[model samples]
Target: MSALTIYKREVSSYFAQPTAYAIIVIFLLIVMSLTFTFGGFIPAGDASLASQFFAWHPWVFMFLAPAVGMKLWTDEQRNGTLELLGTFPLSTRSAIIGKFLAAATVWFAALLLTFPIVITVNYLGDPDNGTIISGYLGSFLVCCTFLAITMLVSACTRDQVVCLIVSVAVCFVMVVGGFDPVTTVLSRSVSEGLAEAATAAFVWDHFSTLTRGLFRLQDLIWFGSIIVVCLLGTSAILSAKRS
Candidate 1:
């Protein structure tokens, strides 16, 4: 089978269930609630959503993205389909990429549904459209990063609940490792240098730059590196298991 065939199957499987719709609705509710309430979008009188709407994406995706991806491999293993998948006329890498793209597509649809917020921001004030686009791109990347991390974890186990817990824990670290509160606490308990290193490793450090419309090359590289590494790791683990 071609990668396209696998991709189509995965995509069909996602929309066939209520899982995709539920995730999309939950994501919208969480993001919208945070933007209006805790984010103070109205009181701040900001036209841009970078600080409010988009800023919450990493935290939200840390949990939700894993939920969406936890089944990618875990389900296959749980249902004894991994061996069936192995018999297909496709490379493990093709299956991996196909499945990853399918999960990414689900998040893409979810992100698109958030356009009402964009409309609201435009109605309230004149916002920089370029910055807003950057924010969306950043949000999507963060979600993809979490999804990739979850994919890696899912490959290691058949239990979906175990996969979800470990994935969320890893994503949580990525989201908060560089957070001001986290870094401040780390600095006191360890060498300032170690704390700085932790901050550098944080997904936040890379993701926040894009939300601000500062497309630094290094930030892009960092995100790309993480996603690629996790996917490659997943492929390696699956290959070993199949052999």
Candidate 2:
């Protein structure tokens, strides 16, 4: 039928399963607790929410995002529903876009559930709403990028566990590319340009900028490009299967 119909169906499928709710609840609890405890939101003597919220994103997404996205296509393929989906009247591109948007919506809901932290920050001290907004934007973009990567990997296999593991491995490298420990080691052995390029390829560098309330066009482009490339690759794979 229509793209919206597919989108609704996919979104409904996720909500119908208790696993999605469990994942969201568990992820939120872990992130919120870590942000308050390790990130020093309360003990750092600073009212800024940056440390508490943004600090945990890379690590949290390392597992949670992939867990959410691992089933996108893999489950369909496992159930032999993907081929049936192909027989529908909608174009492959529309189906892909619809499914992607549905997954993004689930992620958006997970992000939205963290608003209590936003409220707590606002209540405690003068935090910049602008910066918090930008942080959310950047975090959501990173989630989209991770989800797109997971979707691509999910499309490649019928086993959700395999999809999850592959997605996690891919996402881990991207996250580590921006980590200080990894970058420092790289800078020692490689040129500064190579090190910087590695950092630039991941979500950390761009996300850090956004968390600081600076929304650079290049950062936006980097995240957007990754999503586009992954989704296109996924579409190509599916199209080949149809042929």
Candidate 3:
């Protein structure tokens, strides 16, 4: 009935299956390969993990976050557990928060597993550990946002494939909405003030700023608002369905 009960169950469910481990392994391997091979982390010869390493996180997260979250509710529904869980004496809001915390934990663990990269950077030279920490925090927020979006979509569907595709599509738009061309097009069609505001609304704007080690309240608010809104929407969706 308590949020803690649901949180513990949700998190335990992840380890109860091999799927979570597979996702973590795939994420570490691909991210490391890109960091060393394509990202030119070493050849760049820079102490910062900025553009060379964390730069690829949005793309990496676009796929993997959905993989982790696509089943959050879709599987519950498919297995007839959604309704059963609803009758467990907890509010839908508790379920939403518990699920989000659970997903975020998996993501944070996956991020932690990439510490060898951190070790490499430290070994090579004295990099700004503060900046590195901020970058990881920003990436964690990104994962949470994506998971929130995925959870919302999963709440809307019982088919995991549909949930995955919709979540990916939404996440993709959020990522690309910050690109130069997209911003340019919006600026041309909309009033300059509105266009600028719209472009700033994209994930890339705030996320990139944090990656650069600049901690602004505005950036934190942007991600915080998205996380809260999406998770709330998820709760609403489940509540409506239950009623």
What are the Cα lDDT values of the candidates? 0.91, 0.86, 0.89
Model 3 quality (TM-score): 0.94
lDDT of 1 by residue, 7-100 (tens): 8999999999999999999999999999999999899998878888888999999999999999999999999998888997788888999999
Clashes of each: 0, 0, 0
Poorest lDDT segment (10 consecutive residues) of candidate 1: 203-212
Question: Which candidate, 2 or 3, would have the higher lDDT against the true structure?
Answer: 3
> What is the per-residue lDDT of model 2 for residues 136-235, given as tens digits with 9 covering 90 to 100?
8988998899999999998898899999999999999989888888888889988788888888887789888898899899999999899999999999
Candidate 3 lDDT by residue in tens digits, 1-243: 588888898889998998789999999988989988989988899877988888888888999999999999999999998878877787888888888899889999999999988898899999999999999998999899999999999999999999999999999988888866778888888767766875688788788888899999998998999989998898888878877
**Which of 1 and 2 is the better model by lDDT?**
1
Task: Score candidate 3 by lDDT.
Answer: 0.89
| Model 1 lDDT, full chain set | 0.91
The prediction achieving the highest lDDT against the true structure is: 1
Model 1 TM-score (2 dp): 0.97
Ranking by lDDT: 1, 3, 2
The TM-score values for the models, in the order shown, are 0.97, 0.96, 0.94
The C-alpha stretches of model 2 lying farther than 4 A from their native spots are none
